[model samples]
Target chain A: MSGIQYLFPEYEVVRNDDRCIRCRVCERQCANEVHCYDEGRDKMFSDESKCVNCQRCVSLCPTRALKIVKSDCRLRENANWDSDTIREIYKQAGSGGVLLSSMGNPKPLPVYWDKILINASQVTNPSIDPLREPMETRVFLGKKPEKIVRGEDGRLVTDLPPQLELSLPVMFSAMSYGSISYNAHASLARAAAELGTCYNTGEGGLHEDFYPYGPHTIVQVASGRFGVHEDYLEAGAAIEIKMGQGAKPGIGGHLPGAKVGPDVSRTRMIPEGSDAISPAPHHDIYSIEDLRQLVWSLKEATGHRKPVIVKVAAVHNIAAIASGIARSGADILAIDGFRGGTGAAPTRIRDNVGIPVELALAAVDQRLRDEGIRSQVSLVVGGSIRSSADVVKAVALGADACYIATAAVLALGCHLCRTCQSGKCNWGIATQRPDLVKRLNPDIGSERLINLLTAWKHEIKELMGGMGINSIEALRGNRKMLRGVGLNETELRILGIAHAGE
Target chain B: MKRVYVNEEWCLGCHLCEYNCAFANSGARDMVSALKGKPLVSRIRVEGDGRITYAVSCRHCTDPLCVTCCISGALRREDGVVRIDRGKCVGCLTCVLVCPYGAVAPGPDGAALKCELCLQNSCGAPACAAGCPNRAIVYEEREEERS
Candidate 1:
């Protein structure tokens, strides 16, 4: 019944007549409008083709009556031409357009976090309970003063420039206001404020409502300069120059005109309904010296009050790239791995580009240490840091602190359906639609996020306590507390961690 | 009519919706008593990689393809809600074959299971939406805002 149909639906819906109470809850709850009741027949019915298997109806059926099953609609059995592969090929042949996917890459690539193991204390070093001992997770990100300088009064100089102090060693990563819903930003802002951490504005500029959270915010400057202005540059506690993103390392981003609504338009200082394209590289920043000029310009614009963070995607030569950034007068360097997420990206670029954050962090840390400039700039690593163990591992790998977006969002309730590009999210965290966006009550979102961070903070402390480490400062770059499992010599050497059971 | 809007950005990949959905429909007196490691078979599911996460559930589209492709007379629509009658179903799964969102899945008895918006489950709305700590899964009516 179709002229060149797409991939067929994969499941069927079956309702039981004997259990037909006809409450119609499925009707109201379905966003796809798959379920409807027949008045003339006085019975409930379903259009199985529209069903997404969200199970909202079956779970709420009350009568124990609804079922969805895999369709027997299989293509002829062929290993070379599987159903999904054939469908994908047909889809490409039909549309002749690149398949764009939302979120991180779905390929079963290596995840470095799972392979690295954290060290624990033994009889040599007694383990201390975080609850009973003074285990510190708080970290300050910025330049630390070197050898003490004497003043005229022969007293140590306590004059230190601006720095970001995190109660815990984690800050919400850069996620632009345009990419996520206002409520999502609200939750993050509230959590950052409550947790005494910072949240990056991710080149979307600063929203009027969030300027009040400036002290706890890190305003970003990407290639597009969508919302960059004098006041915007001076607003946040830190100014981050986004050289690249982990999701699509070498490519630029184009926020389709369709998604650029009034709020996003205003926040980004761009014309409404206009495409927001962030170019791959800033025209002004062609070299490291040019990057230096930009950093200095921002410092001059903000009166050198805020720390300047230079964020780069973790590429093959990230260590060398980071060394230049360290000397470029940047206070902090943010390394984002390939596993990072995005609102929308070409499927190919997301899956096949960039390296893992762990390796990048290790290489950068080692390079900075070898250069004897490790203390000049703080290091922050991000891109899919799942649990407290990861945070611990990152610190031991030499990260001064960690920046997280996915985990932060998860605490607020993301399910990872990978449909963010559609912008019809039911939870309201990703969509700009008022009805959907309003559903995310920032109060609850903030509360849940706070709970998650508190839990992670507690866990980080416990992990640190078990390692016989008293503070997060001591844990930084302590590769002695880490071991590699099932990794080759090169990987272990790159990570600067010995193999397990060694 | 109201619908559940997914804010995929807020989804934590926790799969709480599946557990809550399962518990809500479990007909259990308490959530823990029914779902404390009971091989969850909830109507909704979570899908994601390490970086980002979101929930997958019924979208309840306007002109459903599942209805047009059903081999049996089991699939029907009335008052804008598409539902099914197992008694009339042949379990052919033609509906699943045509659904573009991949929202449809196999049920316990090899039947189809999906999100239907809580009409009889706990809470006046949906359990997944209400119990969602992040407010990622919201139940509401769609509006003509994305032009």
Candidate 2:
């Protein structure tokens, strides 16, 4: 034991003695083992230090007796050296390891989606009633033909390039098989199938059970190429080359050996109990030319029937990077913003690196337009697309579609406690342990996801109807429909939107 | 007829169904007032080891053994639900022994008690299925052969 304790427990578990029935449900449900019943005292107690405030015990408490609150305990209040900062320093000193975190960045930063406001039609233009009028939310992601051509017979040619059709402009983004549990993956796959959209398989290989959902899947090949195979490439409507993730932009992924169970190992084609380390960069890809080779190889491998997507993090030169990827023979370009969620990442890189997706999307869209290659590829922006409003805003800013992972997992029962590195997720969304994995029943999980997307589909229609837009295609890249509030001139210029009331 | 069924695969074994069943049938306005600091006499009970668990209650069979064996004529099948009349129960312990599922047990009043699908209680539906966190227990009509 340490001679002196330097840190205080962050949370206090409050149990109402009157309401508690001593059922001990909290004691059994908590994976952290924070709650215990003292048989001698005939009462329940909690070790608050171990509590992650996941609300598992509170949700399961039959009598509504438990509540977790932040402790008021402080250490010489100083804004310059906040309590969390000091505690983090102490933690690093004690453990001598890099600070790791999960989920999206919690730091207070500018959320452009919140600052941007959508325009609504008033007396001048009649807003269509979505309930009575026909509205189209369907979107297709792929390259559009530069010009129309006719055959020798003078009949108009209808053949177009391969495209991934989505009933709505939203998709369940990549959260690999190994990163999330099998039940979680099953839920996403089933929901995507039922919703007529797609879910990315991340860098992890596709599970055999999900093969029937290939039409609603987007197989990925990242740095490690963990599950990349001929059958795997052919099993999806599209393939994404994961150049970098928004969280920890310049680094790679590290799935600890402990989470690599036998099923995860088989799906990822890796040995059980072995750390799955994806290198920082794909050794074969260094320039746009190299990227073009891989794109063409994947296309050739798939009989040139599937569209290939190139995904990159929003960095300093994201516009130039997007331009290069568009010319690299990629059919779709996916840009992930700084506020993206991750299974596990170094806290330093997650909190520090990368640019916001709004600015990146606007910049890339304008750059492609100026280069006369706007139709060369489709643009999909991800990294914290929290709601239908965010989807509408992203589309107006020139995104063909939106990718959402954090929001999808939230529907599948993720509380975002930001402790995924520990792999003790009580919700069963992030862990591979059999007991926790079974906690998420695919039947309930899939139903919830379907409900979320269905609701969003309605909201997206209503928002578009208010804007006097009937289809998502007309809303795509229509920057005039958006205006910024409380944003500086530079911010407004970068986002390519006027100030509100202009 | 709609019957409460257990999937077992998704059952968390937290025994929340048992608590919900007890509280729903307790006839109190709230759970704290209903079953606090007292032994839980739940109509629906969860039975299993740590690996597997499922809630067990009356199956409401077409030919119930408890209804046929009730010596005091307390147990009866009403609208396909195996119900009991506590006023007529003699507490002979015969229903407890004849029941194959062990779903019947003596209540705190020394009367045989079993699940009546919450029809007699304030809850319009089975509380065990309604309170199940993982959808492990579902009250729905299925093919008799499948049940």
Candidate 3:
């Protein structure tokens, strides 16, 4: 009872008098009962603690009439912060724990956007107008062996694995159905069909509506394996086994029961309000051999019609890891870099862990080639692939293509506020609330996404044409065509490319 | 004691809340036709500086003044939530004029509109709180009574 006063402490709005102006806007705008104008007092009176900081009064202040600030109340810094910290602090303060937030990166790390540079064609080589030349931006994603020999029957069949034929190199990455709204998933699926690429159904499994777009979907099976079944397995063009995510490296997701709506619950194969926890480690696979068992099991379950992709978070010795993945009978290997997006992850994991996609791609390509198993599997890289240059760079560095999540969301009008964790997405891109779901027009969203990929495809083809490469196959692993500028000797050596102007 | 509050610094001005609130009140089973081309004015509003935004809703004050401010007694505080009596409201606009926080607004019916805490309009919990992915509009009651 002692802290009740502190928890529901009366809010007041105090003016310094030196900055007082009777604009009367605060009186007109405040949606809380903290402020009042007593005709007897003739001055605006406020109980500051009740202010929710909606800023209505602050913005409407004609002469800067008001400022609403939180009271400077401090809790003891225990250093060992936990739920107990919150309970104890609330017990002491006597009110509900205050919710505070910050969006995007919570860790200090180098953003390669500053390190990477874009090359524009100058007077030396002619930059063709994109409207004139018919650029070929078509990209195929799958395993390409060292050789493709014809059988005695005269049919073109060899030891190469099945691949996904993408109209464009860019495709949406795995974002769980529960993590984002149904409308968002619908938009991606519709866009993938219209644009002739694919969108991944993250570990959350595919919604029933997306079954029509199954041909253009890459369904994922993570450690949790929520919606894995015979029907779910056969519903997509390719199956991706997610070893890790870019944002929350080394950690798994916990879809709080609060967010697991009835539809989400059904899709994820869990009860409503039960925490859908995904463990960091897969209970079945302990080694590369064990991984191969799961791979073959999925292949057997799906009757070998669909290509299986093993996606891993980029880490040290990734090249060695890729070599093992190749021999594991996987059709494709997807390496997620550190800068990928997630629905909800601890502030520490999203920013602190994982390696750069560029570095991981280079190492994995070199390792597989050095092991002579490069032909055994294909590679797709993700985390954050922004533009056509990233797609081209990925191809040259041994990736068959690239997977993009944030960029796809951007095409659907996401501002990258990194507030996806908040279910109140004004853009209707994230959140499962029926009201928010209505905000997204799947038809419009899908079209915009298709338009963006189509635009990027043209740009990619133009770049490839300038390099005298007619097909994506010729450009794959052609690092000689790539030269680095502003990179140190170690980076150049690792990337197996010479410095620009060398 | 459960209530809705807004933190201005984090609001992205996406306006999903408004759409959600409108849909919850629209009474349509499908969302597309209910919201596609309507002038959406929610009981709650987002207010902020040009660079930042936060949502605004009724505080459901302990001793509600809007109920008293109503000249026709159209406004009443029920179960800690402020409600408007549309049938009784004569469109005098007295409640709208006298509200200290501007929480009361003229609805389409010419009656005052304020946050009902989604007691009747919301499908489940308050749509704003249910839809807030960030757990921002928490609907938990305080444990103790005020001094």
Q: What is the C-alpha RMSD of each candidate to the true structure, in Å?
A: 13.7, 1.2, 14.2
Candidate 3 fraction of reference contacts recovered: 0.00
On the 0 to 100 scale, the lDDT of residue B25 in model 3 is: 71
* DockQ versus reference, model 2: 0.84
lDDT of candidate 3 over A1-502, digit per residue (tens): 5624435432235564444434343653343455677757556687765565545455434334466554545456666674334644665466454322213343446544334433445667665555566555676666665766788998877654667888877779998988888878998998898888899999998888789999999989999998878888899999999888767667777777878888999899989878889999788978999999999999999888778999998877788888888899999899988877777777556666778888889989998888888877878989888888888888888888899988888777676645566665555677776645554667668878888887888778788777766567778898877878778888888887777776
Interface RMSD of 1: 11.6
Best by lDDT: 2
Alpha-carbon runs more than 4 Å astray in model 3:
A1-108, A113-132, A153-160, B1-147
User: On lDDT, who's better, 1 or 2?
Assistant: 2
Q: What is the lDDT of residue A249 in candidate 2?
A: 96
TM-score of chain B of each: 0.87, 0.96, 0.86
TM-score of 1: 0.75
Instruction: Estimate the TM-score of every prediction.
Output: 0.75, 0.98, 0.64
Q: Give the CAPRI rating of model 1.
A: incorrect
Across residues A1-502, which tens digit of lDDT does each residue of candidate 2 receive?
4777777899999999999998889998898999999989899999999999888999899888999999998899998999989999988888899999999888898899999999999999989899999999999999999988899999888888899999999998888988999999999999999999999999989999999999999999999999889999999999999999999898999999999988889989999999999999999999999999999999999988999999999999999999999999999999999999999999989999998999999999999999999999999999999999999999999999999999999998888888877888899989898888989999999999999999999999999999999999999999999999999999999899999989
What tens-digit string does per-residue lDDT give for candidate 1 at A254-365? 8877778998998899999899999989989999999999999999999888899999999999999999999999999999999988888888888889999999999999
Candidate with top TM-score is 2
Candidate 1 segments whose C-alpha is farther than 4 A from its true place: A10-26, A41-86, B1-147
> Model 1 scores what on Cα lDDT?
0.82
